[model samples]
Target: MIESPGILYSIGAFLLVIGPLVFVHEMGHYLVARWFGTKVEKFSIGFGREIAGWTDKRGTRWKIGWMPLGGYVQFAGDLNAASQPDPNAGDASAEERAALFQFKPVGQRFLIILAGPMINFLFAIILFMGIFATYGQAQNAPVVSAIMEGSVADQAGFELGDEISAVDGRAIDRFDELADIVRLRPGQQMQFDILRDGRELSITAVTADVTVEDRFGNEARIGRLGVQSAVLEMETLGALQLPGAALTQTLSSLEMITVGLGQIISGRRSIEELGGPLRIAQFSGQTASLGLYAFLFFMAAISINLGFINLLPIPMLDGGHLVFYAAEAIRRRPIKPEAQEWAFRMGLAVLLSFMLMVTVIDLGSFGLWERLSGLIS
Candidate 1:
């Protein structure tokens, strides 16, 4: 095992991953707003005092801020960097109003707000597709390498070297597909079609519920078939197939995350699995040590996460803006500024509280306090 780097190393790694992501996400909004002819005043990376900047030919002040946590784009009619509409935006000249964000059509505004998350998803898909195109897809077939003694597979007569062809009449070509099918169906009976000794046979067995700790160290009960994969192999995909494969993998990963979250909400999974920036930073360094390909894969996964999180309907987020736009569309007018202010304040509180909770968990996971106490002793 590699020795753990100090806290400074983790902080630096965290910045490297988040900096580009924040830039890309904010740029998505900036570019789309420009396309819609809205006047962008300032495009700043980070939230505090300007560290360095240059005004573009288009009259946009692009700058880096002292704080590197998050960023914003200030539009002509914005009340602040948060993109709230200016109170006097409606009273501007026709030409000025035409170039203002708030004066733009609702459809234009919606597209501009939606572009951020969409770009994140698109960026991940393109990255994955490129990676796959360069290096072949690592394939692991649904072939069993072992059956635990006295377990469901052993009781059902499953043997080593048996290849699973289908489950409950559904064809599965990949090991992950088979595993996923079983993992979500604990206590349920399944009909399996397998090829053993060059002969196809059918077997039925009830899945076994196994309590296991997830990657984040949260315990959850999932189904286990008492089977393991033989080995991992790589399958090359043609140029034409790369996009399709990349998209399929992206959707599958997203679906798994959605289901996992649903389980947590439904009391099937533990909420302790919810991690903060520290967990991400720790994993980032670990993954970087693996190889460039592994690191890129981590980036893609994080990109998808960023996209999904921003699309959630919480105040002070991109999704929150979309929600406001939807309300405006339905009511045939913008929401009152007083109400929007309160909502943003509440959203900020919720996000801060969540960050604090996860940070505490991260410290515990890292054994920070334990190590400190040992030093004191």
Candidate 2:
């Protein structure tokens, strides 16, 4: 049986991981709004009723909410956390009207909305920079040290010493890159460029689709290459190289997220693979148990995901707001309030439904469904 972290530890780790991320994300919006001379009414670390809070000198209420799922920043002249323009926004006095976010120029408003996700990405890069500056980067050559017997690689005529040079025309410099490419293309046929005994050759193989369960009982489906690296190496980077390296790592992570999302949308991957707060908590606990470095790495990856997800063009997201601003910039006027309100309502419903679906998936990952079935039977 796989051992799991205690409930208390998981909850604590979850908060440690999430609290700062949410703060950073919301702070992005707050700072940008303030820079544009807009008033930020509230900065919250989560949704729902306030657990503890204090009003700042600027009259912004800083608070922690009971629900730890997500957070928002409420600005002046906004209907709520979604930042919808207030119907009474035009009724404000001159002094208050000047500070209202709704009255800001389209360019300023776009930046204010864009800042949140941009900051998340920046935060992830910073975390990665720290990690590289301290522990360096872990990597291995793309040489096939071993291939599983009768597996896809083996059937594709992969030799033990064959070195992978590329995958489908994309250059592969490291084992991790090759692994990442294969992992995202489960059950799909891929062309591989390899060097076998100093001779260049190409091989085609279909990656095996496999379901893997972590110690915490959370499951994920990934493509398996059935090959191993002979040696793992850590390359230390100088201070000057750290930033670039970190940015590359962040972009690589962002690419993986986008690919996974595309697969889900295209029906190539299962919606059951989507995770919610429960899975995040479990992952937090598991990574924390591994060590500080492990936890930080996990945090950075999740931060990237948070940034990317918010940039989706779906309503109620940062991307959706940007879309509105884009239209305003072109048309030389704001979209109709009635139309905006309807879009927001639709967006809220989509978001709520998504949350519910992921929550159900999270519960199933914990064997809730199996236990319930057994009980019923």
lDDT of 1 by residue, 1-377 (tens): 35544567667766777788888888999999999999999998888999999999989999999988778889899998878778888899998999999989988999998988888888888888988877667678889987889999999899998999999998888888898878876777899999999999999999997888644344557889999886667677888998888898788668767877887788766677677887888777766656678777888888888888888888888899999999999999989999998898898898889889989888877789889999999
The clash count of every prediction, one per candidate, is 0, 0
Over 4 Å off, model 1: 5-9, 160-171, 180-224, 369-377
Check candidate 2 and list the clashing pairs.
none
Q: TM-scores, in order shown?
A: 0.86, 0.95
Q: Considering summed lDDT, which 10 consecutive residues are worst modelled in model 1?
A: 213-222
Cα RMSD (angstroms) for every candidate in the order listed = 3.6, 1.6
RMSD of 2: 1.6
Report the lDDT of model 1 for residue 299. Answer: 83
TM-score winner among the candidates?
2
